[model samples]
Structure formats: structure tokens, C-alpha cells
Target chain A: MRGYAEDKDAYLKRLRRVEGQIRGLQRMIDEDEYCIDVLTQVGAVTKALQAVSLGLLEDHLEHCVAEALAEGGEVADEKLREANQAIARLVRS
Target chain B: MRGYAEDKDAYLKRLRRVEGQIRGLQRMIDEDEYCIDVLTQVGAVTKALQAVSLGLLEDHLEHCVAEALAEGGEVADEKLREANQAIARLVRS
Candidate 1:
């Protein structure tokens, strides 16, 4: 089973919340909200999404990567490498 | 006029796109996409929102802050301080 499968519903809920925030951002712009105000909301949205990613990454490491590491072989190496790359992308983005 | 007022339509358009991305993220989770894959998409969405914030900040500085700095007084100092605080929030986020 996928690491996030158990928490799928939770993840979807968070994504929907983020979607609402994005729409709120549009309304702010349309209504001519202050620039800094919009920026502050955007920062909040960004942090929310970042939280989602971090959660998913944590799950992946706890389950998928953990299982692969326990197996002790090339598969484990590959999984670890993939996780590192994903972490790098998240950091860079 | 607010610095972003001129590009208000563009900003709204971008926010709509970000909204779409957030919805896509929900779809990904509902279908139980791989955790890493979900994380990657989340990172992309985060980057998109960050770009929007950066653009808004740039416009604010170019127009609103520029005008206040040109005036050269307490108003200018207040504007600069506000902008700096906004930037700090963005960086920390």
C-alpha cells in the first residue's frame, strides 16, 4: 500500500482548502485589495501547500522508503536516491 | 492608484491558474497517486503561488514604494519598513 493511502482523505481536504485560498486570492485582486495584503495571503497559501508536501514526504519516508531500506539491496538504494532528489526539488521550488 | 491595479486582470488570471493546480492536486490525492508524485505536484503549486507573490511585491515596490521614497520623509520610511516586513514574511514562508 502507498504511504499516503491511509491518509488520502486528509490530504484531499487540505488540497481543497488550498484551492479555496487560491480563489480568495483572485477575489482579493479583483476587488483591488492592498498589494501587501494579497502578498501576505499568498504567503499563507504557499506555506499551506508546503505543509502538505512535507506531510506526504514524511509518510513516504516512514513507509515506502523504510520498507525498501529493510529489504537491503539495489531497490533500497534506488528508493533512497529518489527520495533525496524529491527533497532537493522541494527545497529548490 | 495601487501598484497592482494596472495588472489586476493578469493577477486574477494567474490566481485562477493556481486555483486549477490546487484542484488538480486534490484529484491526484483522490486517485492515490504515489506519495512522491503528489509531493512533487505540491511543490510545483507552491512555486506558482510564490511567483505570484514575487510579482505583486515587485509591482508594489516599483509604484507604491517608489512614490513614497521619492517624497522622502516619514511616509517614505514607513513604506520602506512595511515593504521590508512583507519581504521577511515571504522569505520565512
Candidate 2:
């Protein structure tokens, strides 16, 4: 099972809400909303997406990475590398 | 007119693409995609949103804020504060 399997529903819910926010942003633009107002909304959506990333990262570390580390082999090394890379991507994003 | 008025269509196009990305994310979750892959896609979407924010900020600075600053008064101060606050929000996100 995937690391986020247990919380899949919650993740889906959050993603769907973000989808709505994106749609809202389009609406704001259509209405010629002020740039700062639009930027504020964009900030909110970015934070929500970051939160989802954090949750997924936590679950992956707790389950997938932990399991691989317990196995103690090349797979463990690969998993650790992948996790770190994802983290770097997260920080850079 | 809003600062982004000249590029409204471009902004809308970008936002629609982001909306599509959000849908793609929901699909990945439904299919139980790997955590790292999901995280990578989230980063892509986040970067896309950040690009939009940056575009709006540039337009605001070039047009709205610039206009207020040219006028040179309390309105200019208010615009500067608002722009700075928006920048802080972007950085924090």
C-alpha cells in the first residue's frame, strides 16, 4: 500500500478544495480584481498546496522510508535519496 | 483598470492550466501514485502559481504602484505598504 493510502480521502478533499480556489482565482481575474487582492488569494492557494505536500512527505517518511530503512540494503539507500530529493524540490518550490 | 489588464488573457490561460494541474493531482491520488511523484507534481503546480504571483507583482509595480508613487503623497505610501505586504505574503508562502 502507498504511504498516503490511509489518508487518501483527506488528501483528495484538500486537493478538491484547492481546485475550487483556482477556479475562484480565475473568477477574480475575470472581474478585474486588484492585483494585491489576487496576489493574496494566490498566496492562500500556495500555502494550501504546501500543506498537502508536507502531509504527503510526512506519511512517506513514516511508512515507506521507515520500512525501507528497516530492510537495510540498496533499496533503503535509494529510498533515502528519493526522499531527500523530494524534500529539496519542496524547499525550492 | 487593474495592473494586469493588458495581460488578462495570458493570466487566464495560465490559471486554467493550473486548474488542469489540480485535476491531474486528483487523478494521481485516485490511482494511488507514488508519494515522490505526487510531491514533484505539487511542486510544479506551486511554481506555476508563484509565476502568476510574480507576473501580477511586476505589473502592479510597473503600473499601479508606479502611478501612486509618481503622484507622491499618502496614496503612494499606502501603495508601497500594500505592495510590501503582498511581497511578504509571497515570500512566506
DockQ of 1: 0.89
**Candidate 1 chain A lowest-lDDT run of ten:** A13-22
- List the candidate 2 regions with Cα displacement exceeding 4 Å: none
Per-residue lDDT of candidate 2, residues A17-43 (tens digit): 999999999999999998999999999
What is the Cα-based TM-score of model 1? Answer: 0.97
Per-residue CA lDDT of model 1 for A1-29, tens digit only, reads: 88988888888888888888888888888
Best by TM-score: 2
Q: What is the interface RMSD of each candidate, in Å?
A: 0.9, 0.5
* Model 2 error, position B31 (Å): 0.3
Worst 10 residues of 2 chain A by lDDT: A84-93
Tell me, by DockQ, which candidate is best: 2
DockQ of each: 0.89, 0.93
- List where candidate 1 sits over 4 angstroms from the true fold: none
